[model samples]
Target: MKILIVDDEVDILTLFKDVLESVGHEVDIAIDGESGLKKFRNKKYDVIVMDYRMHGKNGIDVAEEMLKMDRNTKIIFASADSSIKEKALEMGAVGFLLKPFDIDQIIKEVEKIEKN
Candidate 1:
């Protein structure tokens, strides 16, 4: 699957890109919500994994806009904050994986998407 990962931290972006690519998925990275939204509009991706606490726009806003553009757009939010899971789903995220999750969890989530 083609996946977009958005995070303010460069290391996290690289890590997710590397991990996802290793699993044979095309991966794209954005440093902020604006860039993420721009890329979202410009590309077709199977999934979007975004950070909830970004400096501008935030993941919720980004996902909300993406949903408006394509309601079927699948989104997964990655954050250390557990409290945002409910909000993330309300904003249209199909999954909420907390930061520091194992690669297996990511794979499982993607598998769940594939099932649907």
Candidate 2:
């Protein structure tokens, strides 16, 4: 699946990109929500793995805009903050992964979305 990962942490970005690429998935990394949104506009991704807390635009804000443009967009929140899961889902996120989670969890989530 084509996946976009948006987060402020370089480590997180590199880790996700490495794992997703190793699994033969096309992966793109953005360090912030704005850039992630820009890439979303420029290309089509099967799923977006984003963090809820980010600089400038949060995941909710970005997802809201993305959903506006394409209501079918599949966004999964990979955030340390679990408090926003309900809100994220309500805002159209397909899944939520609380941080410090297993790397395989993300792959599974992406695959799950890919199947749908």
Candidate 3:
């Protein structure tokens, strides 16, 4: 699957990108929501993994605009805050992973979306 990972932290972005790429997926990383959205507009991604907290445009804002353009893309949010879980889903996120989620979790989530 082609996946886009958006996070302010470079470590998380690299880690997720490496792991996902190693498993035969094409993954791209963006340091912020708007950059991620720019890439999103240029490519066709099966899954998008985003961080809730970002510098300029938060994940919520980015995901909202993204869904408006292509609602079929699976958006999986990974955040430390559980408080926004409901809000994320209500906004059209397909899955939410709390911060510190394992690599397997993301893979499974992507695979689940891929199957559909």
Best by TM-score: 2
- Candidate ranking under lDDT, highest first, comes to 2, 3, 1
| Sliding window of 10 residues with minimal summed lDDT for model 1 | 103-112
In terms of lDDT, model 1 sits at 0.89
Best by lDDT: 2
Show the colliding residue pairs in model 1. none
Task: Compute the lDDT of residue 68 as modeled in candidate 2.
Answer: 96
Estimate, for each residue in 23-96, the C-alpha lDDT of model 2 and write its tens digit. Answer: 99999999999999999999999999989888999999999999999999999999999999999999899999
Over 3-31, each residue of candidate 3 has an lDDT whose tens digit, in order, gives 99999999999999998898899999999
TM-score of each: 0.94, 0.97, 0.96
Root-mean-square deviation per candidate: 1.1, 0.7, 0.8
TM-score of 3: 0.96
**Candidate 1: Cα lDDT at 5:** 92
lDDT (0-100) at residue 3 of candidate 1? 94
- Assess the local accuracy of residue 81 in candidate 2 as a C-alpha lDDT between 0 and 100: 96
Q: lDDT per prediction?
A: 0.89, 0.93, 0.92
Runs of candidate 3 exceeding 4 Å displacement = none
